[model samples]
Target: MKGQSYSSISFATPSPKQYSETMLHAQQNHATNALRSESKIIPACLPTPNPSSPNFASRFRTDIVQLVETSNIHKHSDTCYKYWNANRGDKKTCRMRMPRKLVSNSTIDPATGDICMRRSDPWINNFNDYLITACRSNMDIKFIWSGSDAKALVYYITDYVTKT
Candidate 1:
């Protein structure tokens, strides 16, 4: 889907307190080592910077960039083309729909009321800056804008919960 922007997308930014608490909790739980071992993205366990610190903005941005580069960048695998069917003339496509179209800016569609969030990178999964920084893990965040979207999310959650 070249040049196709997402129909509805939004990112919720966590409050400073929320961010700080989450980061503090993560540090207290010793999740840094686990994150390092799992992704090796972080070179060392860095203390969570205070919001008011002079270097907090730079440090936070650096951490988010590193985490996103390590975990949010999408790479194609066999599963990406599992539904490909040359016989049916179906072009190979990733089920998770990686390599999404890049959006220049966030806007709401006048006719459809769909929100298209700005996306500069086509291969990076949707993420929230605060979430990835606080959780230090891969995450996908999207806004539910329509009834269909809400229904689909509910079904997916239910299916996952009921899975044997």
Candidate 2:
């Protein structure tokens, strides 16, 4: 990661043998290290954070917002509690938000006579591209979660993939 101190920290799953070895080594060598301990160490099999090159905080926030938007798109309003309706400004869309008509980077719809989501909006276009990729893909989607079966992947990138 640039503009920061650390390098890339991979979250690739560690084998069971490697895990046990790491645990044993940690116990023998770092028994007194307060910040790090066996308990705080996440298993390599579990998903981990990917800190980035710049301000991870800002990028992380954006990522979270995108994830919520994706969720709202896939799960719809009643299904997800944190669903953020990306098309909130337009009444024609499923979700509605912000009552202001004088928003910047917006245009008045001739039909509705209200400010509507423009075709040039980056947010809408990016989400549309994501939707297309998710829907048209042929491969099985792998979600890092607690269970190994289909039931565990409720919020998967796509609702479902191929063979579980």
Candidate 3:
């Protein structure tokens, strides 16, 4: 029998558009974590002037602010926050944060997947921008342990948002 050609098989890889969209979505979500954490009532609020700490909450807040100011809009879907004071007796954490809203496009349509910015809701932009900025400052905080105990204070930040 003749040798089989490698071209005969097909593998599913995301297209450029899909890849870009995915990266954007991830960046947006991470960026917004800061704002969401701040806005959230749980874990208590931090004191004013916001100390330059590497803590989750501090970094979280800074990230959201950056995303909003930067002119970068990624994939966004309808999402909402629902909190219940009704504590689950078993768990230590009483507060429950759930997504009460649906995940839809900028312009929601049953049959069509067209995103019309002009006709879409206004809150979408403001809220999303907030999120992106928050996420940028909050994700992948495995630094501070990466370097030696030398004099130089090293800080790590992701400038290019790309997928592996």
Please write out the lDDT profile of model 2 over residues 3-108, one tens digit for every residue.
Answer: 3332122111222443354445444434222323345532222222246534443333233233323332232255333454546753333233312132234355
Clashing pairs in 2: none
lDDT of 1 by residue, 89-160 (tens): 998888888888877668888777677777777777888776666677778798889666788899999999
Higher-TM-score candidate of 1 and 2: 1
Pairs clashing within candidate 1: none
Where model 2 places Cα greater than 4 Å from the true spot, the runs are 1-62, 75-105, 109-113, 119-164
Could you tell me every candidate's TM-score relative to the true structure?
Answer: 0.67, 0.19, 0.17
Backbone clash total for model 2 is 0
Residue 131 accuracy (lDDT) in model 1: 64
Ranking by TM-score: 1, 2, 3
Alpha-carbon error at 97 in model 1, in Å? 1.1
Report the error of model 3 at residue 43, Å.
26
- TM-score of predicted structure 3: 0.17
lDDT of 3 by residue, 85-162 (tens): 335444323121221223333342445433222212221232332333334322211112222412123321232333
Error of 2 at 55 (Å): 0.3
